[model samples]
Target: MNKRIDVKEAVLEANRLILHTEDSLSEIKGSMNAKGQMLVDSDQLAFIYLLETDEDFIYAGLPHTIWSKLKEALDKSLPVLLKINDSEVELVQIIDELQYLIDNIKGNANYGEEMETKVTEVFS
Candidate 1:
């Protein structure tokens, strides 16, 4: 019934998330830390997003340090308490990626908005 609508929305949202993550990663890559070093502390990001995987998979977009922590928590069946840093834009991007993961894990088709236009074109 409403599955079509949900899938369409999820696809659009996933695209947005992907774009946001790409932008944030680019911005952060060009930024520096308080010590004038490249922002390399994956243990603590400006913001972090958490999502459970259908499998035991972990989000690979995170820094290895933080990813390890998340993996450890999952392995131990413990809840993760991710740290927060100072990158607001980065935080938003991570959150979007998390939502995208959630949607995909729920079995939503990843056909983006263009798929809808393509379908209309075929029918017309």
Candidate 2:
């Protein structure tokens, strides 16, 4: 009984964490779009993260316009896409590592690395 109770509590905690992370990540993607806009004509991002759900294709984290753009691409019979985003906890660790690499790079401060891995995971 005690073991079962502990397991259930852990599950709840996990769900809570997941929700919080998603919210934070959405914020980051939104922020990046906004900042990029300051430099150029930035378009909202489209995120595709693989998930273990029955439908298997989860699509969310898109702003209204971007999401609208994709709607035309989807056939009427397709499964609904769930938008997941913003994990501040995860973003901090990855961003910190990237920043560390940048700071360590000699002379040129324009060093750039693909944030794709995390991006995939972010949408994932």
Candidate 3:
């Protein structure tokens, strides 16, 4: 006998995950902008890559290359902000959100795998 899956439940869960992921990304972007770390077009492309790939699982976080670039930018700005007694709260918040995104994406990957398995079981 085959087990039945609730398609509506699966879809709703997927949408919830996607929306949470997008919101985290948006928060990171907004915090970066507030901290004066402007993400360029290529950076936007990187976000797309992240959304579509399992690269997050591979790196355990924002892929190293992108993380390095973002870190470099933050490193440069943070010192200046510190020297001038400017606030570092937004920058810290960006880092936190980035970590949250990584965790969120990891869960998403697992959910994707689970969905794939369910589809295969249903069709096979």
Model 2 clash count equals 8
lDDT of 1 at 76: 44
Clashes of each: 0, 8, 0
Superposed on all Cα atoms, the candidates' RMSDs to the truth, in angstroms, are: 18.2, 18.0, 18.9
Candidate 2 weakest lDDT stretch, 10 residues: 1-10
Most accurate candidate by lDDT: 1
Weakest ten-residue segment in model 3 by summed lDDT: 2-11
Model 2 lDDT tens row, 62-117: 32223222232232222232223422111112223323332343243232222332
Q: How close is candidate 3 to the true structure, as a TM-score?
A: 0.24
Residues 61-114 of candidate 1: C-alpha lDDT, one tens digit per residue: 343223333333333434222122333222223333433433332332343444
- The local lDDT score (0 to 100) that residue 105 gets in candidate 3 is 42
Question: 1 or 3, which is superior by TM-score?
Answer: 3
Pairwise lDDT winner, candidates 1 and 2? 1
lDDT by residue for model 3 (44-80), tens: 2222111111212111122222444344433433321
